[model samples]
Target: MRVRPFAVALMTAALTPATLMSCKPSSPPADGAQPPAADAGPSSTQTDTAFAALSKRFLDEGLALNPVSATQIGEHRHDSEIDDLSEAGRNKAIAWNKAMLAELGKLDIQALSRENQVDALIMRNNLEGSLWDSETMQSWAWDPQVYSGLAGGAIYNLMAREFAPMPERLKSATARMEKLPALLAQARENLDPARVPKTHAETVAKQNKGVLSLIDTFITPNAGQLTGEDRKRMDAAIETTRKAVEEHQQWLDGTLVPNAKGEFRIGAERYDQKLKFSLNSSLSRAEIKQRAEAELKRVREEMYKVAQTVLKDKPGAPELPDAPTPDQQQKAIEAALELAYADKPGREEVVDFAKHTLDVATKFTHEKDLVTVPDDPVKIILMPEFQRGVSVAYCDSPGPLDKGLDTYYAISPIPEDWTDTQVYSFLREYNKRLIHVLTIHEAMPGHYLEGVHSSKFPSTLRAVLRSGVFAEGWAVYTERMMADAGYMDNDPLFRLMQLKFYARAVANAILDQGLHVDNWTKEQAMDLMVKQTFQQEREAEGKWVRAQLSSGQLATYFVGAQEHFDTRKAWEAKLGDKFDLKQYHDKVLSYGAPPVRFVRQLMLQEPIQ
Candidate 1:
């Protein structure tokens, strides 16, 4: 579950375009996935042999670098062990990326098949800018011990969530959990106090604070269910593990935070370099920022139009504050939210609705031509306690490497102590704006569809080349697609809500790159989200925090979506009447969720390696 095809700093969009693409493409008259040719580097015969060898070496090196990923993916070639978290482990990866890049450059990408060539380009990109992130950009410097995916995958391996059966899975987990403390100890040692990011340090300190909250809430109450002496041993292990996590948290707070001295924001040069290698997009950073800014202006006007459709009947609902002016927007946004969910039922009703919505939403995928639906039903599970503060709702799919388990549309419960007004206010913001959008993005034809397709993408390189820019991009694309396809059927209010979600995506791109790279203020972030995205104040507040905690990620939804749509349209227009939604989606997703650059080449039957 923690396996990353690429060691992207956050998500794929965070990647810098030049860093992502090595074979330069001149602008085609009509755009396609294939980039312009590199200066005829080498003859095809000479390059293909070396390129094929490069692919195997890279995949082998990647797995060796991330053993936990191998175990999580059901490869189980190394299930008995965990990763060494020492400085050596980190350095080995850096050296591997450098070596891989050097080997990749020895071959000519234009000589390979379109798909293999794309893979090669991705390899070059992942190695170039990605190396800077791992070596120097030092995001881990801000927050090093964010290993919940490791912990979460430990549960995933034990549970029958993946292809693993109950006994084998559980046995592996038990062994790994037994060794977890040593791994955590290594994490503590290798993770430097002096290099930690301040905000990252703070957030991680808090998340770790919730580590023991896991035992208090789940394990302590359920320990007795374990079998015989196994139960006793497991109980003892959990307690020790819980204490270990707590001790680490104390070290983080008492030792690390006080001395964590790294710059919170990556300086412009580092950010630029990271962006170039990571994104692999055709556009440069300034170009992406410019496109995002233009999108911001366009989405703002579109947001007002959508809000008018939803709130035409409600007086004072048209009031939207300016992106440059945050306070006024915050107050107005709060008021619109108050009006939206004014009739919301109790908290139980909200949770119950989310459950039902998943049921209803999943049914549509199979019944409609929207996409090829999954046979394994998507599961709408409850959110784990340890992951609550980040967001109230998220869709967690089976790891692309794993198969068979239901993808969870996890929703957090509202706090029991809130007054009716506060509950209503929160529910109102979500019910109309967030929930349905999340449903489409996470479940039907969004992450769920992307998750399955990613599992099938032929190359490990393509999988690593996976872009949040593409994944969230595809999901957000669906928000608009579903509406255009008449989702919720004739309910303009829902469609209006859909646009609001898009507005959020567009604004998110602006907020993330702008805030971290440009040092935009809280007011600046909030105002843009609320005024331009039509996001409620509470929603904007949460998104702002999410952008900070996760830099370079917010751009994925909007940028990814646009690339998917644009690429599909180019192919369709080129395919000229041969286009079918089912066919297009099949071809588009069949290559897995790589950067649009790679996906275009794959769909057009070109090489990536």
Candidate 2:
């Protein structure tokens, strides 16, 4: 599955901060904080300096406001703190966002450097989006996942990485654990069951206990590392948090799940607004639908051609026609895909296979000289229990602030209760060839590679608020790029799998809007994924649950890829004979994963908006 790097970060209304600092800037001056008397109109250098200063100030204050996120970002000063989820706490965050945005607006973006202009836009969108989420969308009152992610991340972030010593991280985890009860209480108090979606309530109920597992896996083992009073506090904190989680789980089942009467769909009006902020793209819902539908038709045609090549002489191969009907096309493609699915991994071998594929993909990228491959280590691991029931896989890159840490390419393990038939369905979907494509998307020259490059960019603000559009889009874009460059010696089965994978991204764009805005039925969604996109039964069902659980996110893969393709085409056009694929890839990534349009503008030297 494609990675959702900003999944929780975007959904939750917090703007995560940079590393530690005590001093913070004062409130924004009136008139949007105009320049000093000595300078009526600030020079280019002055505007740049002012914006940099403001950006630093926001990061400092933001870390204090949201310490869980701070810990996740490798900011250790706030490691012992957690964001207050109460009404007053949210208002305080909202007010701070407003103040930072006001100070941001005072700067002359035109006069500032192109890079800083992108930072300003990112900061503005995050601030505005946070306010809208709190004031208008009000997800806090309805979305239990928002709070659950926060609770789980508070413990997970501190222990998942070793940015600090184990003993130090354990102390921080204990502090956060001591705060878990109040966070859970605030979640129970703030969430109105009548407004919570049933799917969300059920999922969070399942996930709430997963925190206990995180405590056990990451915390319990290391408790012995601490001595004397520290060990005592750790033991006591763990017991306290375990009780709190158990009680919270009871409420989730007995109260929230029973009373969850809310609609999962946000409706068209809200989806349109959220898409603008979520994507940060000029493309409208109509435009995305138009392009995705067109790509759907085009990719299916390409897949049918591949089917003809693969099934050319097989005894029971479906008839392949030059101008096939829709039914004929579906059969031909399915016949070809089945051949690829025949080489399936044992359920127990999925993680080992994924690790092997990562090595293969990394080797291929290095051999191809595709882009500058980072030496940053990526580890393939099982998806944590708390974060399951969403996507099957993800790329968990370390926080940009946390240098030299390993990036995780986490694949969800096969569920124990799944029938043999269900497991077969899953293994077939994530077959040997497709697993290579998946590894390329989630690891090599994908999210992991892009993240390494993004962190190296000079601006802290840009790294803090890196663009999901660019990150996801670049990952999706690399799938096709790798296939074109003859990954696996241009194996047609691998190419077929790559197209099928790309088709899912195309299908996601259509699926996202259809489910959230157009009121698509389960049957309609199934037809799109299964019949049209050729997804396995297991994959389609999981996506149905994920679609309801998320909004506007499903569109990112398609939209981001489209923008990336456009950026590359523009670069090629501008550079003409001088264009180099490796150079283009390196240059684009160096921009810290801004919106594709901004990357294009920065590359082509166009006017920054």
Best by TM-score: 2
What is the clash tally of candidate 2? 0
Q: lDDT per residue, candidate 2, 315-416, as tens digits?
A: 988888899998899899988988999998887887788888888889989999999987556777789765653445678766756666666779877777
Residue lDDT tens for model 1, 1-609: 111333532212222322111011112111122232344344654565567666666655565565565544334655655655456766776777777877777776667656557666676766666567666765433455445445444444444344554445444555666767876676576567777766666766776645445445544555555577666666667767777777777887788778777655665676566556555555566766787788766654554444444555676564553342444444444444445456453577655766666776677665677777766665667777555534457766543334344556677777666678767667776774457666777767777666665556445445444565666677778788877777787565566567666777777767767776898888887768776566667777777766666655556566677777778887887789777887788777776566776677666655453
Model 1 lDDT vs. the true structure? 0.60
Task: Give the poorly placed runs of model 1, Cα more than 4 Å off.
Answer: 1-54, 140-142, 146-194, 213-243, 307-339, 343-345, 355-368, 384-393, 411-422, 432-434, 576-578, 603-609
What's model 1's TM-score?
0.80
Q: Model 2 misses residue 460 by how many Å?
A: 0.6
**What residue pairs are clashing in model 2?**
none
